[model samples]
Target: MNLSQNLIHEIKSLIAKAKEGAIRSVDHHRTVMYWHIGERIFNEEQQGKNRADYGNYLIKYLSEQLQPEYGSAFSYRQLELMRQFYRTFPIANSLRSQLSWTHYRLLLRIDNEDKREYYIAETVKNNWSVRQMERQINSQLFERLLLSNDKESILAVARNEVIPTNPNEIIKDPLVLEFLGLKRESAYYEKDFEQAIITNLQDFLLELGNGFSFVARQKRIHLDGDEFFIDLIFYNRLLQCFVLFEIKTHKLTHEDLGQLQMYVNYYDRVEKVAHEKPTIGVLLCADKNDAVVKYSLPENNNSILASQYQLYLPTEEQLLKEIRREIEILNKNDE
Candidate 1:
């Protein structure tokens, strides 16, 4: 190409890159600005201790004056949200530009600090969108982790750079698969459920939680001149490992665990790179007994897990009862 032509191409590329960067910078500035505005509003609101009603009135008056000048961005609800946003994240420097205003709004709704921080770290680390963050929070991701890990370990995972060192750190014992939209009593084959997971793969991966990316479905493996097919394969970027899944529509059995172990061994020996961590295996089934899972696997079983999958969203009462039961178990064990 001629020098002038090359120069024009380079100019166009630079312009496009600059425009992208400018847009990102503007968004970052806007996020920080809103955080500061929230802080100011919260401080002012506290100053009127006796007139508890003053905050609402002030927001209304501000909206009236700013709406025409600032457009919908300065609406009463948005300003109120900004105030709450500041209350949620008191430190301005903690505001992450990767998370949009919508994400902060969702985070503010979570009352527990530990849970909120867990979601924040996971969202930023996994690059989750606002919708994904909301879904995970609603699904009780923190509670699930707490159930699977000790208090100190769970808190450490939530608060620090220490990535999960074992499969149990990231795996949920009973995975809620309501996102698949399968009817509760639907007479579906295991293959059907597997196919649905593959079809709605993106949603499934989100439901699977952080670090998971689809690798293959019904992946073929050859062993000792014989062939076997693995149901689903995923690679978790956070764990730096491959995940092999076997789907079952019935109660879990020792054979199922044995089969998964073999697959895990095969992947670790033949498929896993030298630098990568050990391969993890999961048996996703309809129902599982903790005792069965415990006795079936080896004493130091960290690479293999058995998790139950639900077809429908549990009732609120049932969910609450389950949470209570989990808490009770933890309390009893503590004694």
Candidate 2:
């Protein structure tokens, strides 16, 4: 390239970096300002309970006063959201710079502290845009994670207070495939679904949860004279192992589980390092039988898991029901 061309490119890159920095600075300060407003309002509300009670009147008055000077951003409803933002995240020091006012506003709606904390940690870890954050919340990522594991363990992992010790710790049941933009009415093949997942790989990785990176698609495996192909391969740095996924367009069967087990064993014996943990295999199917899943695997099996896949986002109630059902079973077993 010519010197002039190179110079122009360098200047453009520098300008882009500066613009990004300026945006971050504006967002961080805006978040802090909202927090301060929330803090002051909360203190006033506390004093009101002991002395005078302004209640809704105070918020309305502040909105009126602030809007005249600060513009429409400080409207009555927005002010209320800021107050909630402060109430939900009491400690100022805990706020992340990467997140903006919009991020906290969405987070404040969650009544569960552990769920809120998990979202915060994942938001930062994933560097998710505000829109991505909203989608994840609406999809009930926290609640879905609860379905595959104990509530306490899921909460602990989400908060970054504890590392995942096994595959189930990072795995989620009924992996949501809404991002793939596929309709259920049309007849589909496993490769079609696999291709869709690859096309929307970024969203797929997010749906797969944290610490996942794509390794291969239609990954080949050679055992003696026979050659086999796995649909998808992902490596989880947190789990320190490769995660193999096989796509199935129909209900899972015993033979399907056996195939995945073989893949897991192949990866463990051949691909995995001695220090790394066992490779985790997921048989993602349209449907699965719990009884078949239980009987197919050994008594102490953690490496292979059967998870159903849905083309649409799951309702929060659906997740809650499953969690409650699992908890009830555990309680019964305890008794």
Candidate 3:
């Protein structure tokens, strides 16, 4: 018996499809296996009256016995992580095969149930990678949201698919730049910092918060045979607007605000679609003068914001002072 050329081709295609399916099935099974392992470890730890000490001893003994045979996967750290995996997601049925164990590891660190749930929803909704998820968690996305809105509103936005409409809803005031690894006392130029941000663009985007998708760096614009370039361009799906950012190393100036306004105008008129909301322009600077910002921008300004970026994390005392100042200002306004 001889096979026809068409039959051979069809058989090859079927074999390829079968192989692909098998690979997918294997991955699915692996994920399930890890989840079950985590679940079993969790239950055993709970059964022990002294769960914490028991867990520690279990991991230590398990690693001593299993590491030689099973390799690094069965080590103390890995077993501890597996135990945490079960604790984080106690309900076995709730485990999602689409998400990797790494994703759950990050979620386990978040102690707040509502916050963890919000991240879970946002991660799945945005299709964020594990790195992105970790970045968001580290940046304290939940705390930032809490500061901006009431509990009801925050939970509503998280549970439902409702995207934030206002800039304040998502934007962090003192944007952290520790990821850039710049020294506080280092006399680096604005261009140097901006370039570093460009180099670490993916991390920068994650730091920028949710809904931001990078569009361009130093994006060129041409008008009347003259050319201008915007420092950074991004689209925020949650805000339904284009976000334009300008970097400044020195204290923010009126000129900087004016320049950002111009960029915002250009984006609104030339770049933004009719269905989209107004374009937002952010001036990322080392320091900002509140009076200068108030005087430069319009009273009802919502499209433009001046945010100070810190190379290093500020001390708790400094943060407390800032909070106190904000409270004072709010009190005065109420008066």
- TM-score for each model: 0.83, 0.91, 0.73
| Model 3 Cα lDDT, one tens digit per residue, 39-62 | 777677678856559867766887
Candidate 1 off by > 4 Å: 1-20, 158-160, 222-226, 237-240, 268-278, 312-320, 327-335
> Which window of 10 residues has the lowest lDDT sum in candidate 3?
142-151
Clash count, candidate 2: 0
TM-score comparison, 1 vs 2, better candidate = 2
Q: What is the lDDT of residue 120 in candidate 3?
A: 83
Off by over 4 Å in 2: 4-14, 44-53
Q: Candidate 2: lDDT of 293? A: 97
In angstroms, give how far residue 32 of model 1 lies from its true place: 2.5
Over 49-137, each residue of candidate 2 has an lDDT whose tens digit, in order, gives 75565747778999988999999999999888888888878889988998988888888888887888778888887889999999899
Cα lDDT tens digits for candidate 1, 191-215: 8999889888888887787678899
- Cα lDDT, model 1, residue 254: 91
Task: TM-score for candidate 1, please give it.
Answer: 0.83
Model 3's number of clashes is 0
Cα lDDT listed for each candidate: 0.83, 0.88, 0.80
